[model samples]
Target: MDLTLAQEAGGSSLLSLLPFLIILLLFVPLFLNGRKQRRQMQETQAMQSALEDGDVVITTSGLRGTIVDASYEDTIDLEIADGVVTTWLRVAIREKVAPDTTSEDDSADSSGSTGTSESKPTIH
Candidate 1:
């Protein structure tokens, strides 16, 4: 009888704490995701503020261009083509283009003749 009473007491205590545990589980992920999004927004703002002329960048709209003038506080002129410049909001710029770093050896291996007997099948 005493063991059954103890078990009931323990079960009630766990039930009392269940709501708090559920709330904690639900809020933890939301708080962590909000923090991560805030950090990403700060990083994007810093990148936008650091833009300068001659930097190659892509916009959020997927337009690729080179910065021709960034003298304005909130706008920049981008040269998308030869002698064609367009103004865009600084916030529209997504990220600076990274330089291609393909090594000469890799290019030569792909393009050079490998003294193999197997020839590429020609399509008529």
Candidate 2:
């Protein structure tokens, strides 16, 4: 009976630690998911920065456009549709188009003028 009592004490002590262990296990996956999301954001930013004129990009708001121009000031000009031109800051641009397709071949042709250091034009 004395040995059985000692064993019961040890079992309860181990059971007391189980909740803490379960909480730690749950947190581990959340931490790893956050890391993965951060990495994806960095990758997306890098891709956005690589955007140039003629690269088709989709905005965060789901506005698809071809990048008509890119500048050092973190802004770009987009032509969302035929005869439509708009200027948006870099943060507004989202996904980039797949490479190797020429923007010249795109049937949705829109005309736009590139902004310069000396001029700011009204964009649609």
Measured by lDDT, the strongest candidate is 1
Model 1, 3-107: lDDT tens digits are: 999999999999999999999999999999999999999999999999998888999999999899999999999999899999999999988886453355568
Model-by-model lDDT, in order? 0.90, 0.83
List where candidate 1 sits over 4 angstroms from the true fold: 100-124
lDDT minimum window of 10 residues, candidate 2: 107-116
For each candidate, give its TM-score against the true structure: 0.78, 0.74
Candidate 1 has its poorest 10 consecutive residues by lDDT at 97-106
Query: Model 2 Cα displacement at 58 (Å)?
Result: 0.9
Clashes of each: 0, 0
Count: clashes, candidate 1:
0
Candidate 1, residue 53: the lDDT equals 89
